[model samples]
Target: MEQTWRWFGEQDPIPLDHVKQTGATGVVTALHHLPAGQVWQPEEIAKRKHVIEEAGLSWSVCESIPTEDSIKRGDANARRAIDTWKDSLANLGRAGVPVVCYNFMPILDWTRTDLMFRLPTTGYALRFDMIDFVAYDVFMLKRNRASQSYDPLLVEKAEQRIAGKSEEQKKLLETNIIAGLPGGASAQTRSSISSLIESFQGIDDETMRGNLFAFLKEIVPVAEEFNVRLAIHPDDPPFPLFGLPRVLSTASDIRRLLAAYESPANGITLCTGSYGSRPDNDLVAITREFAHRVNFAHLRNTTVEPDGSFYEAEHLEGDTDMVTVIELLLREEEEAGRQGRRPRIPMRPDHGHLLAGDIDRQTNPGYSYNGRLKGLAELRGVIRALTRGI
Candidate 1:
């Protein structure tokens, strides 16, 4: 495993030099300024690569080239969106970036009601309280069929959750949900979210998945043509949200995704945090099973509540068996080398606790400098120990 850091272009509060100092030799980033459904020029790709190299880091993975909503919903503009996606893949391959990471979640990329869920030992961590999200979805956004989306008990819990929140706290929740993350990824508001979820009226999980396969049918060949690996990231929280279907969630979903194109270029970004959010997902088994098709990895862990609420835990402290996961990946890399398919899988610490001086500074919620630095160091040590043994 090659250690990589996700840097959000030049304007990121954390500088490139800071990344280099973190001992990450590779960078995972994207043309964040570009709109979702646009073609990425080869020149732009080269420029970003050059910028990364100039900072003493190689560009390892394209963190994302956004999968436009049009493609996911299989709308009229899907063909154009997919064409643009292929263009970007080609451009990336030409520029020598090996992996492209993306997701197919609707409306929001990743949702969290609490960005600063505090732990006594670790300071603040990102949290997704089901009750908070349901409260927002039902009472605030008031999406069609929102109540039906939850069980009676859960709906009551959400009602109780929101009923207690003060007006200021409620506003904060809305802002956090809709303010988006860094790199110009916009968020969905009450009005826009409802309108967007409406687009998927007739689309169910299987239908949406079929649409995903249809997308791969066109783009997978382009990826193979350019010797690029298209790594689809799993859905964050790995479940349905706001009555919309989430296709990329579990090992079963992973099997389906890989089976779609049956090509090496078609792959998965094995994100432990995202998949591990669900208690059913065995992180070690999933990583081992999809080792051959894994193009990139996002290594982080979370502690979950029985009712599906979760908060980011330290790299080594959460429910996920971090040592086993890393060991499996190291063995997978070694096994790949034994065959003719040796590949340096790029991985980054997915998200981290916002701790120390990072709390005082302006920071992206899950992307604080200090928090991820701590995570990367912990993961790097584990990787080093495993590789040295190997």
Candidate 2:
């Protein structure tokens, strides 16, 4: 595993110098200033790479190169979007970046109802409260047919939850749900979200999955040609929201995705926090099965509740057996080495808790520096311990 850190470019409060201090020699980032569907020029890619190199860090992976909504819907604009995506892929490969981690989630990306869910340790972690999300969906955003999306009992609870929220609290909930967190495709307003959902009116899961396959069929070949591995990130929370269809949420979904284009370029980003959100997803099994296809990994953990809500947990302390997961990944690397392939999977500590002085400073939600540094240190310790005496 090559340790990497996700940086939001120059605008990120945590600068590249700070990243180098964390002891992660690789940086996973993107040219976030560029909009989706636009080609990332080779010069721009080189420039960003130069910046990371200057900081004594290599640009190991592109965290994302935003998969535009048009691509996800497979609508009229999808052709243009796919072409531009290929152009970007070629540019990135030419720049020597190997992995690209992207998601196909419509509208929102890695959503949560609470961005600052305080943990028992007094540190804040990202959280998805089912009741809060449902309440905001059915009552706040007021999406059409939203009530029909949830269980009757859950709907009742959401109604009660909404009734208790003050106007200020309701606004906060709306912001957290749609106003966008760091690395999301875009920040959306209520009207924008409604329009986006309406745009996908007739597109159900089957239609959405078909669109994703169509995308892979066209793009995977280009990725393979460019020597770039396309790692599709799983749907955060691993569930549908705002009645939108999610194609990459479970192990079955991943199986279908990989089968769509059977090539080394086509792979998955193993995000434990995202896939582990669902109790039914066997994280260990998923890792072992997809080890060969894993181009990148987000090694984080989460504590799931029975009601579908979950909170970011310490890197090694949640529902996931972080040690076993790391052990499997190590074995994969060892096996690849034996086969004359040096596939060093790039991993970063994701969605860390807001601890110490980071709580008072202005920081991207779930991306505070001190918090992630703590996570990386812990994960590094695990790797060392597991590899000891081997």
Candidate 3:
């Protein structure tokens, strides 16, 4: 495994010099300043690459190049959006960046209802409370047909929960759900989000799946031409939200994706936290099955509640079997090496708890320096122990 860190370029509070200290030789990032559906000019890509290289680190993976909503909805602008995405992909591949991780989730991307859920240790972790989310959908954003998506009992509980909150608390809840997290899509206001949800009114799971496949068909060939591996990130929370369709939440969903566009360039980003949010997803099995097609990995864990809510857990402490998952990845790497292929898979510690000195500083929601440093150190220990027979 090639250890990497996610660095939100230039504007990030954590400096590149600090990243070098974390023992990660690679960086996973994107051109966040550029708006969605815009072409990534070659010069901009070179500039970002130069900065990462100057810091004694390599840009191992382009975390994402923003799959625009136009493409997701298969709207009138989708053709232009797909062409721009291909242009960006070619530019990245020209720069020698190996892996490109992206997602096909419509509207929102990797949402959470609580960004600062305090853990028992007094540190904060990202959380998704099902009741709180349902409350937000039904009472706050007021998406049409939102109440119908959730269980009747859960909807009743959400109504009760919303009735008890003050205005300030309600606003914060809305912000957490739609204000967008670090590296996510642009923040959405109540009115804007409602309209976005309305735009997808007729797009169901099957429709959304078709749109994703159509988008892939156009871009995967470009990726293959440029020698870039396209890895579709699993849907965060691994379920539907805001009455939107979810097509990348389970093993069956992934099987369909890989089969739709058969090629090494058409792959998956094995994010343990995203898939592990659902108990039905067997992480070890998924890893073993897709090991050859995994272009990147986000190694994090989550402790899930019975009600479809979950909180970020220590990298090795959650429901996921970290040791076994890593063991399978290493075995896959060994086999790839035997076949004269690139053996190192770029992986980063996905998210970490806000702890110690990081408790007071203003940092990106789940991306504080001290927190991720601790996670990387723990993961490094595991990788070393597994490989050296220690």
Candidate 4:
């Protein structure tokens, strides 16, 4: 697989030079400054591309062309939003960036209750504790019917967790969960996010699935026209949240989506951390099953509990079978190589633990340099070992 890093352009604390030092030759990013559903003018794409090339790296993937809320909810502006999204894809393709990652979840890109949950040995990792989340949902954000989402016992525990916190701690918890993580796709304050969550009260899982299909039906053809691969990122946590339905969480979900368009341009960004949050999503099997449909990858792991909570783990040491997953990807690449097709998928170290000097420095929540460097080094070792044996 080709190694890449997610770069946040000029403002990133870990600049492109530092990314080059990590042995990543490609970058996965987007015009985060642009609002969702707006056209990505070719000039903007070229400027970002120029910066990456100057740093001796290619912009391998546009980490996203964000889906508009109107499109996801099938509101009146859906057509205009999707048209803008398609326009962005066409311009990206024109700029010679072929792969674009996107997501369809109604609200939030990814949610975690703890940004720096301390570990016994390796420092801190991003975490999602059910109690912490439920406390926010039921007691803090006070989303409608949030209490019903959890079991009666879990709801009680949420109450206890909320009761045990200081006011300052409660505010921090809410901000971490809602203000969005570093480089997150969506962000809002407590009032705005709560209202956004409430807006989807009438939309059920089936309706959400239909909306996703409606989105793919319109955009997939544009992707094909531009020769761009639309790699839809799996819903983080792989489940519903804030009472909103999440469609792209399981293997069957991808299969259904592939069937929706039945084209190579319609692809999956197989994020291990996102799908791996669900214990039932066998990463190896899913990799094999959807080998040809995958256009991008985000290789990371999580230590998930039997309950829905999980925390980011060392790239290889979490709940996922990282070895088998990478082995499968290598096998897929090898097969593609013999067929004269794109041989390797583009991937990055999704998230890394904060270690050593990083524990004290003010770094982007999960984009700490030292930890990701360690992660990329470890992953590169696995790639080399597998190659040597082969």
Instruction: Note the Cα lDDT for every prediction shown.
Output: 0.86, 0.89, 0.89, 0.86
What's the true lDDT of residue 47 in model 3? 98
User: Which 10 successive residues of model 2 have the least lDDT summed?
Assistant: 179-188
Candidate 1 wrongly placed segments (more than 4 Å): 180-188
Q: Tens digits of per-residue lDDT for model 1 on 140-187?
A: 988878899898899999999899999999988977776542222254
Among all windows of 10 consecutive residues in model 4, the one with the lowest summed lDDT is 179-188
Sort by lDDT, top down from the best:
3, 2, 1, 4
TM-score (all chains, Cα) for each model? 0.97, 0.97, 0.97, 0.96
Alpha-carbon error at 16 in model 1, in Å?
A: 0.7
lDDT of 4 at 249: 96
Q: In model 3, how many backbone clashes occur?
A: 0
Candidate 1 lDDT at 3 equals 93
Q: Could you tally the backbone clashes for each prediction?
A: 0, 0, 0, 0
TM-score of 3: 0.97
Candidate 3 C-alpha lDDT tens digits along 1-390: 999999999999888999999999999999988877689999999999999999999999998998888888889998898999999999999999989999988877778888889988898999999999999999888877788888999999999999999999998888888755333335556777778788888899999899999988898998988889888999887898888889999999999999998998898999999999999999999998889889899999999999999999999999999999988888888788889776488999998999988888879889988889988999999999888862
Better of 3 and 4 by TM-score: 3
Stretches of candidate 4 exceeding 4 Å from the true structure: 181-187
Candidate 1 vs candidate 3: which has greater lDDT? 3
Model 2, global lDDT:
0.89
